[model samples]
Target: MTLRRLMTACVIAAGIAGSASMVASPARAQSAMEAEIIGFHQLCEKGDRKACIRFGILIGRNEQRNADWRRAHADWFWFER
Candidate 1:
């Protein structure tokens, strides 16, 4: 009800909103990355040697990124063998 209280509440609300946006930003970036990875995947499947290398580098480090890499690997064993 007081001006001081109102300003404190506003600051809290702004902090919460800012944090939520920060959390959301990574998900957006990840989806964009996934899209790029998918495009590379398609290219790799179609016999683009350079694309295959790029795809592996982008999604071959950890288990999370490796999920896509595994799928692509299975689908493109011809290239591997």
Candidate 2:
């Protein structure tokens, strides 16, 4: 009986840990992307022409991925160009 209880507790702990990681995965990805963009932008600001183009391209691609966001920020996109 004691061994069975230990096995069940281990399973439950594993499941909780797995679900928690799944939930945080997307948030981590978004932050990483944001950080990458920020790095490109900083480099661009420091007069790196290639970084400027890369930053613009990344922003454009990201904006195009979400129609509603693209529409809402249409002018900002044009201004960036």
**In TM-score terms, which candidate is top?**
1
CA RMSD of all predictions? 6.9, 6.0
TM-scores for every candidate against the unseen true structure: 0.44, 0.43
lDDT of 1 by residue, 1-81 (tens): 699999999999999999998887764344787788889989987999999999878876667657655675576445655
Model 2 misplacement above 4 A? 1-30, 64-81
What would you estimate as the lDDT of candidate 2? 0.74
Ten consecutive residues with minimal summed lDDT in candidate 1? 72-81
Count of backbone clashes, every candidate in sequence: 0, 0
lDDT of each: 0.78, 0.74
Compute the lDDT of residue 19 as modeled in candidate 2: 97
Tens digit of lDDT per residue, candidate 2, span 30-78? Answer: 4676678778878987999999998777777855544544565576456
Candidate 2 pairs with clashing backbones = none
